[model samples]
Target: MSFGAQVLGTLGGIVVATLGGTLVYGAIRLTVGLRLDQEDEYNGADLSIHKISATPERESLG
Candidate 1:
């Protein structure tokens, strides 16, 4: 309840969250992967992942 206690709690929370996020991200990167290939990036996520265009009519106009 005191100011010192509140500050300490906030710092502890930040440290815990940062470490937890780093571990989870590292695990995913080592396993299923985290980044897309160049073709996936250029074609876009909507087409690569979902196998469909997000806006086919509008895209054709350009």
Candidate 2:
């Protein structure tokens, strides 16, 4: 009903959401893991998954 109450409610919602998301991701990391392996990390995600560089650069002055 008041501007101050609205702001406080929004801030509280954000804090709860952030903590909930962190807990979910932490559980997943502990069980399945979340990252690229050595070779994949070295090669980069685009080259590994899409078979192309994320940013292609032409070396010509045309």
Candidate 3:
């Protein structure tokens, strides 16, 4: 292959790899955020952190 062709091929490979990595990272971050939101909902983080309680009997430890 010519030198120009080799350089282009290398650049293309790099671009594709970078895009793939970005997509994977975004997916992982989204999944983690959703899971954290679910946990916060279940454990009542708002009550503990923000002093807002759905149940009046629950008190903020902070």
Clashes (backbone N, CA, C under 3 Å), per candidate, total: 0, 0, 0
lDDT of each: 0.94, 0.89, 0.77
Question: Worst ten-residue run, lDDT, model 3?
Answer: 53-62
Per-residue alpha-carbon lDDT of candidate 1 for residues 1-62, written as tens digits (9 for 90 to 100): 89999999999999999999999999999998997899999999999999998788887899
Model 2 poorest ten-residue lDDT run: 53-62
Best candidate, TM-score: 1
lDDT, candidate 3, at 18: 100
Q: Quote the positional error of residue 38 for candidate 1 in Å.
A: 1.3
Of 2 and 3, the candidate ahead on lDDT is 2
Model 3 collision count: 0
Please identify model 1 stretches exceeding 4 Å from their true place: none
Point to the candidate with the largest lDDT. 1
Better of 1 and 2 by lDDT: 1
Candidate 3, residue 41: lDDT: 68
Cα lDDT tens digits for candidate 3, 3-59: 999999999999999999999889998876524465566778766458677755645
Rank the candidate models, highest lDDT first.
1, 2, 3
- Deviation in Å, model 2, residue 21 alpha carbon: 1.3
